[model samples]
Target: PVHAARLTYEAMRVGAPARRLAKSLQPLAGRCDARLVYAYADHASALAADSGPRLLQVADEMEQIGALRYATEAAAYAADAFAREGRQDSARQAAARCRALNARGHGAVLPAMSELDNNAVMLTPRESQLVQLASQGLSNADIAERLVLSVRTVESHLYRAMQKLGVSDHHKL
Candidate 1:
């Protein structure tokens, strides 16, 4: 089942049509591992098709079955899809799920998830403050002085924060 799941994901990544991939996954569907993978594949397909509700539903099922990583990723996808569809409430709900999963140490630090308006970059409080100051146009040295930290420390904080935010530039903060 795991092998089948890996093949399914690999096939999808290589641009196979969803119907073809679904047919391939069909035989493995009755197995537990394969079912989890199928749920993930379905969630991905729903997201690609802009089916926000279906995406969320599949994500919820994944989470219920303890597929934490996939569930978290699905929720993030659902959030983005919902936002694009102008379903603000649903988007917020999905974003909240992503945040919750991350907080519980289930989700990866995903840049795409950070793009959601309601989803703040996952940062330490100090990092958050540093990013806020940087966003206000404070120079690193000036921010260091304002925060009473050494310039090197400020730069380190900024670098780590940017890394966590999946951004290459402070301006993106």
Candidate 2:
């Protein structure tokens, strides 16, 4: 069930058609697992529906279940939903909760949130892609080669991405 939820969540994250898959997994929300797969399923469904309120509810439930990782991921999803809805204050609150959870060492940071600024502003797509590669320890030249771009362009992208993410260096990415 947890694996199904994770697969659904990944599908939704990529903007794939996951509404049917999420609906099919809705019945598992009552089941128990070490990682609280039920809550993860609910969160994934809410994401598929673009429902911020439901995501927030799932985040609260995840916190109660001691699933800090899922809680933070849900909060980050809720933050993004709220931002898209023009609810800046609510988005900020959710993002702050996510940051607090990470700061307390409750769980690993969500990969999607890794490229956010201190205030949870999202990085551009190019910026996010560059940051992900750099975080994997790829050098500018290597990234350039892989992306089929000039080394200078790769460095520029990394520099701008790092600046937006508030990282002083690529090593920090």
Candidate 3:
């Protein structure tokens, strides 16, 4: 169920019109972080101009439910929604909420909040490992062998990681 929610949330996050998948989780709305998914789906429509406010409402509600992590993520999503609408003022407020949530918690930046932090680079787990390995002088083939992945896959992950790091060469990984 958690996996399903993640897949649905990711789909919605990437601008996929996967509301049907999100709707399927409506029954679980009051449990296991489903409320956030459902709320995202509700605001995922094209004309949902109130996404920031609505999502922030959900974030506050999640706080009352003791789902601080989800609340922070929802607030981050709210920040993005506001940014997309050119609402810089609202976006900054949402960003502040996200930071507060992070400080109140373990201070670990959640995936959703990474975009709100300019100092953070959003890297996939695989890309992070590839960068770490490449930094240690592991060739693509060596990384492939160590991780049981294809050489092409290793190269691809390294290429993307370097791009995210704004390095022109894998040697900088």
| Alpha-carbon TM-score of each model against the true structure | 0.57, 0.56, 0.50
lDDT of each: 0.70, 0.71, 0.67
lDDT of 2 by residue, 1-173 (tens): 66666676667656666577677567655554545666667777787787768888887888888776767777787878877887766776777677666655454656756533433445567877888899999999999999999999988878876655446778977
TM-score of 1: 0.57
Evaluated with TM-score, which candidate comes out highest? 1
How does model 3 score by TM-score?
Answer: 0.50
Model 2 — which ten-residue stretch has the worst lDDT? 114-123
Q: Give the poorly placed runs of model 3, Cα more than 4 Å off.
A: 1-18, 30-50, 118-173
Greater lDDT among 1 and 3 belongs to: 1
**Candidate that beats the other on TM-score, 2 or 3, i.e. the better one:** 2
Query: Which ranges in model 2 have alpha carbons more than 4 Å from their true place?
Result: 1-18, 30-35, 118-173
lDDT tens readout by residue for model 3, 76-129 = 878887777777667767777876776676678677776663323455788877
